[model samples]
Target: MGRTDELFFEMIETYQRHAQTARNAKYQETHEMAEILLNMDITAMWCLTQRTPDTRSRLI
Candidate 1:
């Protein structure tokens, strides 16, 4: 598989783990860590697709 594909798959797993962490965490710091992972997920997905919010609507 391509490096991008690998990265994306890893990102997906990380996102899933973080989502679970967020669900279980009760402290503010833990919540912040989970939010950071969520942001990473978004950024990784954007990178895989080469996208930005200001760009024209993507076909995918």
Candidate 2:
């Protein structure tokens, strides 16, 4: 894959890790994040950092 594809997959992996962490911690938002990562397509996942309020704030 190209660099953009690599980065995109990396982002997905990072988000999946975070979701697992949140689920382990029993945070209320865990389900929401996990759902987004699990159910959304690549385009939607790419926009996730901007679409999710909490994630946007934390990431940016």
Candidate 3:
């Protein structure tokens, strides 16, 4: 898998592990984030938000 994919999965795993011991409110937020990541169309989302270097410079 690509580096980005590996990092994304690792982030999800971290959140899942945190959810196991996180307090109620923090647990809920982490759990939700993990679920969203699990279900999201990550590549499509990245494509939709990806900016060219020119556009990136304009936002600064």
Candidate 4:
């Protein structure tokens, strides 16, 4: 993989690890909510990129 891809995956892993660590903490309610939302948003964007466009994708 390219360096950029490796870096990207590393960042994702870091976020996931942080999420897990926060989940184990006592005062993590707000942090958990924010982390979950951030994860969801990033996942949604990645899924969107994987979709094959039915129209005018490459031309645009």
Candidate 5:
């Protein structure tokens, strides 16, 4: 194979690997959230929020 073809294949492989990593992370997050809800006995609602770098306020 030519150098250009090799580079193209390498780029595709890298992209697929990165995509799989993202997919796995998302799956893990979902599984953890489900486990938390299942193990909780309270009727309280669960919310996920991210803290901003500049403020104490949380973004849901």
Candidate 6:
């Protein structure tokens, strides 16, 4: 994997961790917002990977 790929995965992990933290803290609104953001990030990542066959292969 390249540096960019590593950074992308790190970002996703961070968002997921933050969402769980918010949920654990009983911040329902924050948790929901975090979840939404996480989904958006994943969607964006998927779309970006789809733009290149090499990236799509690496992802799989």
**Predicted model with the maximum TM-score:** 1
Error of 2 at 48 (Å): 9.5
lDDT of each: 0.75, 0.62, 0.50, 0.58, 0.42, 0.73
Task: Kindly list the per-residue Cα lDDT of model 3 for residues 1-60, writing each as its tens digit.
Answer: 545555546655665654544434455677676556544544433442353444334335
Residue lDDT tens for model 1, 12-51: 8988999999889999899899989899897877776674
lDDT per residue, candidate 2, 1-60, as tens digits? Answer: 545455557877866776676577566677676657655545556585555565556545
Candidate 5 C-alpha lDDT tens digits along 1-60? 545444445555655555555456557776565445443412221211122232213212
Each prediction's total of clashing residue pairs, residues at least 3 apart in sequence or on different chains, is 0, 0, 0, 0, 0, 0
Model 5 TM-score is 0.41
Q: Is candidate 3 or 6 superior in TM-score?
A: 6
Candidate 6 lDDT by residue in tens digits, 1-60:
776677668777877786676577566787777778778777877776877677788768
Assess every candidate by TM-score.
Answer: 0.68, 0.45, 0.38, 0.44, 0.41, 0.63
Off by over 4 Å in 5: 26-60
RMSD of 4: 7.1
- For model 3, the local distance difference test gives 0.50
State how far residue 55 of model 1 sits from its true place (Å): 17
lDDT (10s digit) by residue, model 4, range 1-60:
545445446657766766666576566686777577668757754654456352225324
Error of 1 at 25 (Å): 0.3
Candidate 3 — which residues are off by over 4 angstroms? 23-60
Number of the candidate with higher lDDT, 1 or 5: 1
Question: Where does candidate 1 stray beyond 4 Å?
Answer: 51-59
Candidate 6 versus the native: TM-score?
0.63
